[model samples]
Target: MSETRPLLEVSHVSRVIDGKTILDDVSLSLERGDLKVVIGPSGGGKSTLLQCVNFLQVPDSGDVFLDGQSAREMSRRNICEFRQKIGMIFQDFNLFDHLCARDNVAIALQKVKGQKKALARQRAMAELERVGLADKAALYPSQLSGGQKQRVSLARALAMDPMAMLLDEPTSALDPELIGEVLNVIAQLSLSGMTMLMATHQIGFARHLTKEIIFMEAGRVVEAGPPKILEPGGGGRAAEFCAKLAQVTGR
Candidate 1:
């Protein structure tokens, strides 16, 4: 892959749930090494779009291509292959309750890459340290703060060394004051040039973090452009959405 080739592409994609259209003819292209932020109101299917890209939720129609190959055409084995290149972080830290943070990060590496226990443990600890949680590696999810747990979740995602990351409202479940710590980790990732697509309402931080902003409504992307072009009060529904988000972000 050349630096300029799109890392992912989507064309005329649609999805439905119980006859209700969730996405309709959505089209998008993601450039390699670009950070893209997706923003939308509640029920707008922003998360669903990410799910489709990961093949967690299949689309009803149209195509999604990663590295120019249609995700829709990929077999189950190939879908797993594709997912290895993508990492996802959810709003709720999905760490296993019975497992400690280190185990949480190690299990995926063991299962996915078939690495031996000693190697996986070493990698997991390194991942934890990167997220500022080296000492907490032995602690279970029940023993950690929400922000700490989310950081562990980030570590688990990063342990895979994915080609791209998809984050779905990563800080939505935290207290207002705690949100910054999680966002700070993400900010560092952005500064490190991680290719990412994040769905979030943190407008001020997002504008500063991402190269482009994508606005979706009713399962369809309605606008996409440089962050400066879509700042609060720029215009249209996207502007209105940004304006509301800005009030929360204190912009």
Candidate 2:
């Protein structure tokens, strides 16, 4: 007999760097198509958790399971394979200034996936179109606004055909006027059944789109529940952050 498990699971994961604990016994689970938001104050380990999940930062101790396979057991090469299944979109956009938007998205497919240049270019254009940037494909990073650059970064991740995505402050670096466009793309991904673990301060988006909201503090997962946990007067630091975000966004 066989039993199926969650698409992603972080169990009792802990990480300490230079005598400071960045993540302490944190755990999370995501079934396929689950969109979970993680929000907290600065230094709360939200970003670190996503890093560990992607294996960009190995935890000091613990296990991460992607689609029921133990990441802990992967060798260096295996770990690389594991990460290809988990896409990461950064706050900084991280696009190469010399690379046009289409190349920025296609380079990974050509280099890592070993696709021919022509095929990679075709797929890259399709992903750019998905993010509403097909026309901008010929543009370079310096020619694009902050939001457009971020969408190009997102397109790069999608071209990898990831099983799930890890987003670290996806819109935090955008201009106030530009944040909505990036959020709209992310909101569509949620509606289209993309499994994602997002660390963000976008409380309004959390309220409407996330299936679960996780709040971390001092490296610990202090609270995790449905969006109702952020209701007025809801107890704890998570609620405090939610309230403050609501006030700032006028939600």
Candidate 3:
């Protein structure tokens, strides 16, 4: 890839579900190690946008590019390979109820990456440790707290050695107290230079860590720019929305 090229690009993407347009000609780009935050009200299409970027929900129009390669042009097998290189973290902790934390993280490594059981478990442990969950590795999802379960989810995604991550409100399902723990891990990932595009309602956290914020409304990117665009009196849509959010949350 050329030095000027983006690591990930979503070009003119649109998605329609049951005649309702969920996305409308959305486009964005992420350079290697860049972190971009997508913020909007519920039902504004942030999740669908992220899903399209990862090809989890194929767009009806437009294409996604990774490392200068077009996803729409790739074969079915190639699309699967493309997804493996980009991790998706969901709002719910999607760990297997029957698997312990270690096995939960190791399962994808073994099944998807074709690693041997022992090596997969080894890598799983390292990732669990990275997320500060090594001590809980023996625990099953049923025994873990909401925060721990989310950490296990993070470990599972990290075990894949993803080049970039798309997080869709990863902390949304957690309790207020639990939100911080997961946010802390995400903060660590950002500081470690992980390429991430996150859709979140944590405006304060997003403002502190992200250089750019993309504000979506009614299936369109209404505003996008530096954190300054969200500052008081900045006059951007993002700033106005955030000011209202602050009034409600009292933050």
Compared with the true structure, model 2 gives a TM-score of: 0.96
- How would the candidate models be sorted by TM-score, starting from the highest? 3, 2, 1
TM-score of each: 0.95, 0.96, 0.97
Candidate 3 residue 227 Cα shift, in angstroms, is 1.0
Clashes of each: 0, 0, 0
As for TM-score, the candidate ahead, 2 or 3, is: 3
Give lDDT: candidate 2, residue 55. Answer: 84
> Candidate 3, which segments miss by more than 4 Å at Cα?
none
Once superposed on the true structure, which residue ranges of model 1 sit more than 4 Å away at CA? 247-250
RMSD values for the candidates in order, in angstroms, are 1.5, 1.4, 1.0
Worst lDDT 10-window in candidate 1: 228-237
Q: Per-residue alpha-carbon lDDT of model 3 for 189-215, expressed as tens digits?
A: 989999999999999999899999999
